[model samples]
Target: MDESVRFDPKSPLFVNDPHGMLSILRERHPVLWGGEARALSGRVFSVWHLFSYADVGAALKDARLMREIRHVLTDEELGRAVPIPEEFQTLVNSQRNMMLFRDPPDHTRLRTLVNKAFTPRMVERLASHIQDIATDLLEPWPAGQRFDLVQEFAFPLPVIVIAELLGVPKADRDRIKSWSRIFTQVLDVEVSLETLVRGNQMTKDFRDYFRDLIAERRRNPQQDLISNLIQVTDDDGGQLSLEELLDMGILLLVAGHETTRNLIANAAWIMCRMPGLADALRRQPDLVPGAIEEVLRLEPPVMLTSRFLAEDLSIQGTAMKRGDEVSLWLAAANRDPAVFAEPDAFRPDRSPNRHLAFGQGIHYCLGAPLARQEGAIALKTLLTRYPRLTLAEADLTWTASTTFRSLTALEVETSAAPQ
Candidate 1:
């Protein structure tokens, strides 16, 4: 433990070039014990950063480490830290019930019910539909003109697809997108009171909207996921409760698109910087999947995820006590030299590429197949249609978030219209 290697989560250097800081941490302090700091509302919090690939991988699957919020903070502590008014108990309860924040038996049960909906076969069936959406979104962009790709394409593509999949009415998509953005702030390590309040309101809005949708689905089921989930039964022959259904809807609506949206935007930014990469993909459409994987490895949407020690554990001789939060730098792990040769280089054809972008073990991302399909189709369609795409702006602004590594806007231009 190097007492001098203190990590500031909000440092501009950390946010702008995390891979560089991660390299220093991996080499010097693979398992750094970052002492206490005031994060949420003056509540002191401690963090342990696991930077090395082997350490992070082991910590991810270690039963001694847990993701449930209760392991890190009590209900009272959470309430105090977030400081939501008593009137918003429903909001708090709904957040607490999210499958991402639950431990097993509950995690197992919730995952089991939703597993059938996201199988590779089911996601593959939507490929053509995804391509259609990409075409529809791109058709409106004028040839030889600048357009904000984040607003025009990256964000809407996934939101529209997920909303349609969930059977959400097309008219409600704008409101849903707004709510989804507000709600995602809760995932950040440093959140403001305003953000928390906005999140509560967003949760209430989602619950109200989904309640009616769930009832409609119950009365008149359709050929969509919400309808299927309404009738989905666990092995014990139990269906999702009203609250569970609502939470699931919110989760899918938000998580389904947020990361994928970033994935597409990041891929586009990378392509614009790497000359001829897009043209290469245009020449060989078969490389799209590998290109998407490379983008994920290089610029993962979600940079870090946290887990708390369920019991005292030691990693590479760094002792950690129970209840200490471990921040797994997934972005760091993805570029680990031990696993990846030329860790900093972007090689789409890098075989045996095993990145932790989707995570591992039971808590692996549920929408991975869907995200991959969307990424492949979205990037391939864009490059194939516009063979001469380039960045319209040199100064790009990234989203101000600790969890998500995303651009606020991506302006791009094409030399000509689709052939």
Candidate 2:
């Protein structure tokens, strides 16, 4: 409702071409302002968008604001939003219990349980494994031939690594993928009733599968993440509840796979467009780390985060009353001119990169190390193996997930007469 904020709900700029709108918001109104936000179904939600690095970072730093909004759902709102049947809530709740939805003490406890599993040392170990996985997947891609990187590498790499960590058989990855796709649909702001129904079934199916797996792990424990989690307990000798474990499983599967998939695809697509940067990486592989940082800055996979104003607070000269919705336009913030010089240009070796692609404050991404490792290995391996890479097709299409930004397919011609 600010006087300077302007929005065009009917314009295609609001829908298919939001980056253009975002550029306008960044240039003109970089703080709280009105704009058209889109749903998964391409429906527009009139939202007061913020594009400034300072404003967006401040919003994310607000601990009072809750990120996940399922807890405050009313019966009517839940019905319209999630579309899951009422009877299924308890079952869904059991299978999908993670720290992501909780607050304070509960979140503290849940995160404590899982945090140890993702320590820097553990991530380093996983990084080595990730490198091997990336190499194996990349080997078969007929160097000079065209292939979908998302299908062959990006999507499968993290899924396989996470699956292996969970003691999930490689044979079961397809099932995990199916369940993950359905589970993700339910997270969409606008989901089909049919998708909700199918998602409910997928949740149940995932829970049941994990239930059986846990039972087996209990009997014959293996040296895997699940076994490790089962062995650990609280001071009261209370183990992770069945619900907690199931949700963690779901979280690891989806979070482990989806984000990295997008990161890989998006980074690859961006690099393809910026041939000089890719050439730079090929020439000086040491710059791969810098390139990864730049990728995180420019086209972060998890682009948007939602926060609710927990109490009346004024920020950026705007009154934020309790219960007001605040959208953290992280993708927009990463490109804010105030933060990065030449923010839009793809520049590897760009020093002092403090982009919040992994977020900030207490709720930062737990898998930051793993994601970075996966990206570095994936990009480095591609360049090392082929030495030459080119986009096989122009006008790359993007995936339709609002929260996760990635290429639908990146058709690349590798081994193109090595530069």
Taking all chains together, the TM-score of candidate 2 against the true structure is 0.88
lDDT value, candidate 1, whole model: 0.84
Consecutive 10-residue window with the lowest summed lDDT within model 2: 39-48
Compose the digit string of candidate 2's lDDT tens values, residues 1-419: 45765655234334334466677776776656455555323333334556778888887776777754444333343344544466456435644366665666777777777776456776777777888888889888867887888889888888888788888977898999878777766665455767777777787889899989999999999978888777777666656787788888888787767788888887788777777777788889898988898888877887777776566667667665554566677888898888799888877868899898888776678888888888899999887776567899877666565566667777888875666
Question: Which candidate has the highest TM-score of all?
Answer: 1
Which of the numbered candidates is closest to the native, going by highest lDDT? 1
lDDT of each: 0.84, 0.74
**Candidate 1 residue spans exceeding 4 A from truth:** 37-45, 69-84, 417-419
Candidate 2: residue pairs that collide? none
